[model samples]
Target: MTRALPSGIGLMPVRRPDDHRPRLDRLSAVPITDLARRFSAATPTSARDLDRLDGDLMLRGFAPVGTGVLRRILSRPSFFWMGKSFRRVDDELIAGHNFFTALGGSRGLPFAATIGPSVVDGRPAVRIDYGDPRLAGPRLTRRLYDELREIEPGLWLGPGFLRIGQRRVTVCWFAVDSSVGYGEVR
Candidate 1:
């Protein structure tokens, strides 16, 4: 029963090649202890929710639901083509962007998303927005929005529902291996 972001809130800003100083929300500004706690509570639960846990949860932007539960959505074939970037601006702030291609292939559009500090779901979680991380820059980045909960220092997980053909499938978790995530890509 989760609802999508409003129609025109726009995408979160991303660091562009030309901009030397870009303004972004600093996660450090938010309470650390609370953020961590909220993240742990959002893990996969119940039969349907628990099923999403797989391999490399951190890399997929989620935390270990439990000691044994894992998540591997990022490397999943659906997200293999996905590329992302992150830069540590301050202590708690991790600036980044996620580029995915699903609806794009059929709709002739591109998906570029950004995540940052926010208060949603009645707790502290990262707000993910689809569109140009560059905003109104030359690229068509903004499209939709999703909220991610941090499981640990460098891992996150968020529910992603997508429309494929006629049915909308719920992609319960996504990983963002913030640590080594950007080592290969820009």
Candidate 2:
């Protein structure tokens, strides 16, 4: 008979963050390659994880590599975007929208996206794609694709890519945490 080791025995004692804030801080300070490696190693966000994240998801933006001071500053919260709100539209598609705090937290520039399964770094991932004109506005904005992996329970990490002339370039690194509250967008 096969036997399983008791809990915490014959297993790696990996220390994980109690919350996403400290974890995000650590990821933001690491080299971009290290962050990508972590993302690559993380598990793909499962349907159960998305179901648990069906409300307003908090966001933390990390500056891309080689960016100047201003870009790094703008990557911080409340500067570029606040967070994203997600709702299950169908059995396989989750409708999503982004919110900003520019005018006292008004939900303006309401672009749309869909979170679905996709491949990233030759592995499975939950990709937020804005390629549908009906969902996302403007061709330029539609070229953005962000793939997410579940780093920890209720915490996800992803790299945002912008397609430019058939080439995808990494624009920024971001984290989505379902553990925090940021006032749902109406």
Candidate 3:
């Protein structure tokens, strides 16, 4: 039986890949979206093209590790939301993303992201933007562009700024390998 989906942002075509289907009996009761988001991640190839990325780091934002009081402030008060998995399919990049709710809880919101390959300041980079049906009216969701660069082997970084309402904050964006926190997330 097909259920008519509720209208809102971040809901997509739920025709997921085989790797995204169920496997764990322990988690059988969990919603398919939650389960799929956790299991659907891929790792990026160490190449210069965005189209070639099969998967990449599921970025978890920690305490802002940079200069300026604003950067610290932007990251401190809000709880961190991490996207554990990202994969490329037919030129589209899909992320298993979680978001911080204003009430201090976090939830996963599946959405499509657009990544453009380019050179920024002579460094290999890709410009990333969350596509339409975005999280609206949120401080972190509006007015943003993520510029991710290949910093090292198996490492990518997004040097981005976010505008929340009227205030803007420089965001610390970078993702480590999925194995970095395997025990914690898995």
Candidate 4:
């Protein structure tokens, strides 16, 4: 025999558990027109040629070290919001992959991570990995860029070269659009 609840009592439906979907509150959608406008306004015509250097960091061979570099950089407070994984596809190669809220906390900064052969035609011409955040200051950005150029000249100044073990890596500087929620490096 089954027992019935009181007429005045209300029954609440049980919710089925599933894969956790990240809340959209943390993600901001910025208009493309606004991004373009800001890009043009900030960038100079002389250095505009650097715009073509954009793409994903394909970890085809250097998966371990590449992943380590990403992890190390993300560990910092500046890049705390940059999700773990890098860009997987090559659809609209602007600077790096569009980081869809994967890793980091609520206040985490959103940026792109790309590694590939080159930075040609804005498709990662060489094996380069870049992280650009909107929160970083101009001085900090310049300092990081200069440091990279000094430490790993091969990875930064030169074309590109693969590192077998745990070696120092370079993090390039890029511009971030807080209004729209995206970034791009020079």
Candidate 5:
């Protein structure tokens, strides 16, 4: 059975490498546009899989949604965001927050969200919504939306969007690597 892609983005042509570390490294070196395209080609993951990623302290990698030097700069660690932590809140939704390496320790931020199954860009994905007043901050954080797809055994990728009135603006591209931790980046 062949399904149509949503135009522009297409399936990633290269076969995924066997070793996750090399795969992650190769992905990290690709252009942001390629990352987004690869994400579209990836498989949608379940909340149970995400919950299993808990306690692993997923390593974070990101790229800006735009082109040029700033995009590359932001992708590099400036200590703004470290990684994310996931926990199952119920059968359907998974609760998690961004954990930053700050103040001499891991500082989990209040930019939390609930993860669940959803359709994004015409394909199945796991969504992260920060709309709950109790989970996310009442202001800007509430406008943030994200989604993820599994690219490898323990690697996932997604885009972060900011809701502006009726428009959802793509702000950045992010990845969570469950295969590695804070102390294991090489």
Candidate 6:
């Protein structure tokens, strides 16, 4: 019979020593050689691209774990944008403000212009437009992630844990193509 340790001591019964071994169950399926090969082959120009690709590949390769992490990051309330120009009403609206207005104005038609308050926030809130319709679908998001990965290799990609508002959140970055688009990730 084994003697019980004192209550104050941080000692617990050891069942099987082998049972306590770190399990690599989830990591086992992924071939390290293949991953290393792919990583080595990748020629990302910047961190952003690397991050985007990392997130995409992680999601595709790991499924539930990848997606679960992404959802947590994106769902954070604090990950939103906020401030003034976001709510400013400009009298002389630029052509790029609205494609419809730009086209109509160019055709010598009077177009009404208005400004409304908008919230902008996220992991990298400065670069994203939260209300964009293209960002509404997962497929687009994934595609964006892939494109960014290729274009900006050095950016933070996704499928990783982040501490946000006292909770762990997972976030990802992706790209989208729009007829009325402006600016790059930098």
Return the candidate ranking by lDDT, descending: 2, 5, 3, 1, 4, 6
Which should have the higher lDDT, number 5 or number 6? Answer: 5
Number of colliding residue pairs in each model: 15, 0, 3, 18, 0, 22
Candidate 2, superposed: residue stretches over 4 Å from native? 1-20, 68-71, 108-119, 183-186
Give per-residue CA lDDT, model 6, range 25-55, as digits (tens): 2222444343333333334333222122210
Model with the higher TM-score, candidate 5 or 6: 5
Spell out the clash pairs found in candidate 2: none
lDDT, candidate 4, 45-140, per-residue tens:
122223333322111011122355643443332332332122223342222222322232221112232333222123222222323342232332
CA displacement after TM-score superposition, residue 58 of candidate 5 (Å) = 3.6
Candidate with the greatest TM-score versus the true structure = 2
Instruction: Pick the winner on lDDT between candidates 2 and 4.
Output: 2
Q: Model 2: number of clashes?
A: 0
Considering lDDT, which of the candidate structures 1 and 3 is the better prediction for this target? 3
Candidate with better lDDT, 3 vs 4: 3
**For model 1, the run of ten residues with the poorest summed lDDT:** 16-25
Predicted structure with the largest lDDT when compared to the true one: 2
TM-score per candidate, chains pooled? 0.37, 0.75, 0.44, 0.19, 0.72, 0.17
| Residue 177 Cα positional deviation in candidate 5, in Å, after optimal superposition | 0.5
Quantify how close model 1 is to the true structure by its C-alpha RMSD in Å: 14.1
**Position 120, candidate 2: lDDT:** 52
- In candidate 2 the C-alpha lDDT for residue 96 amounts to 67
**Stretches of candidate 5 above 4 Å error?**
1-24, 106-120, 182-186
Whole-model Cα lDDT of every candidate shown, in order? 0.36, 0.62, 0.37, 0.25, 0.59, 0.22
Q: Which ten residues in a row have the lowest lDDT in candidate 3?
A: 16-25
lDDT by residue for model 2 (83-118), tens? 666666555556666655554454322233334555
Q: Give the TM-score of candidate 2.
A: 0.75
